[model samples]
Target: MVAVDDMNRRILNLLKADGKLTYREIAAKLRRSPSTVRDRIRRMEDYNVILGYAAIVDREITGMKADAIVLADVEDGVSVRDLRKLNGVDGVAEVSAVSGDRRVIIRLRAHDSETLDTIISNKLIPAGLKDVEVRIIMEEIMRFPGTS
Candidate 1:
């Protein structure tokens, strides 16, 4: 991880609040010159510290209510190694090996229950997944890395 100074932290925090916030606004908040702020932001971008930015939209406002994160316990003796090979599994959010309950906690988003089932029964299972457990999210609690 790159070491960031107080100014860098301040800049990042400000950006986190509103990535669209202007450099002048950021400078005003950090009590630095706008040019300095701009340069710092550029340097951060070059260093890949500032990865990217996105807009946050409320799902309810967008009529996307069927969203959920499905966690499956692969049955059919499908090894964790093979489950990772599934086509629909984009970016393994987390993988944990446990004794009792969930062997692999895969995070996935779907538009509706049908899509969710298709993703699980069609794609994942056919890819060698057997035993599976699913947890449909009724609400989206949080999303992090702030899209960056």
Candidate 2:
């Protein structure tokens, strides 16, 4: 595992809060040199600990009025990549292939529940997914790599 020190954790926390923060800005907040912060960030990236940045937008404000957690029972020949390309699939946040009743879990967004239903009943069924169970996401309580 990649060893992350307290400084590294602090840097990650800062980035998580606002990814657009410049290296100099982060350095100022952490009371460190810009080069030091840069080096640490580079090392984290090298270790694959620091993934790319994303803009966390409010779905309601973006017209994505609906979101769902879809548990798909994929057949033997089904591909996860194919599922990701389906229409109205704003994001394929998670796809886990495990030994269980459901093969994959996917998070997706659409303009409304009707659109989501159409995407599932029309698109997913024909794409070799044997069965699907969908649950609307009410709220996002927590996300990964949390600051605490």
Candidate 3:
């Protein structure tokens, strides 16, 4: 395992809060040399501790008006790799094999309620998901790494 020291944790926190922060900017905040900060970040990236950065987009602005969390039971003999196929399906955001009564969980988004229902009834059901429970996301209280 990669041993992340206190300094590295601080650097990670800064980067998580603002991925666009330059090494010099992070160094200034952490009171460390820019090169030192740069090296630590590079090491973390190489170890896959620090994955790629991306923009936190507003779903509404992108015409996505509906969001839902779908919990379902995976069919017999179906693998998590099989569930991964949903990743390419429209309105499917994230698919996870979680520890719960509903082992397979999916994060979905769509243009409206009708579309959301269609995705669940058509795509998800046809894909071998059973006993599906979809909970509409009324509000997102907090988004990790950064607030939405």
Candidate 4:
């Protein structure tokens, strides 16, 4: 990880929700000069401290109407990539190999439960699905990627 100074940390905090912040805005927030803020931001970008900026659209409001957390145990022969590339897989949030009982835990989301089930039943578990569990979230209590 890149080491960030207090001013840079403050700069990132200011830009997390609004990526289009002018250098002047960030400088004002950190109580620094605009040129200093610009240089730091440029260094951050060059070093990958700041990746690309994006607007986060709410999936539920935008007709990504449903989502499910499919937890499963695969056989020893399977791999994380094998479970990751499934139909209706919006994104493979994380795939980690387990310790005691199962092979891996996969987090995938989709537009609906039927799609989610099909992905799990057909692809993910076929590797050696010892067991499976599903959770359909009714509401998102915590917000996305809040301040660190």
How many clashes does each candidate structure show, in the order listed?
Answer: 7, 0, 0, 0
List model 3 lDDT by residue over 20-139, tens digit each.
Answer: 999999999999999999999999999999878878889989999899999999788877568877878999988889888888889999999999999999899888898899899999
Taken over the whole model, the C-alpha lDDT of each candidate is 0.69, 0.78, 0.88, 0.70
2 against 3, candidate with superior TM-score: 3
Clashing pairs in 3: none
In angstroms, the error of model 4 at 137 is 1.1
Q: What is the per-residue lDDT of model 4 for residues 30-87, given as tens digits with 9 covering 90 to 100?
A: 7889999898888999999998787766777766656656566766676655654553
What are the TM-scores, per candidate, against the unseen true structure?
A: 0.68, 0.74, 0.88, 0.70
lDDT of each residue in 93-146, candidate 2, tens digit only: 455555578777767678898988887777666776877889999877876643
In model 3, where is the ten-residue run with the lowest total lDDT?
139-148
Clashing pairs in 1: 73-131, 73-133, 74-131, 75-130, 75-131, 76-130, 76-131
Q: Which stretches of candidate 1 lie over 4 Å from their true place?
A: 72-104, 126-131, 141-148
Decoy 3 TM-score against native = 0.88
Off by over 4 Å in 4: 79-105, 126-130, 145-148
By TM-score rank, best first, the candidates go 3, 2, 4, 1
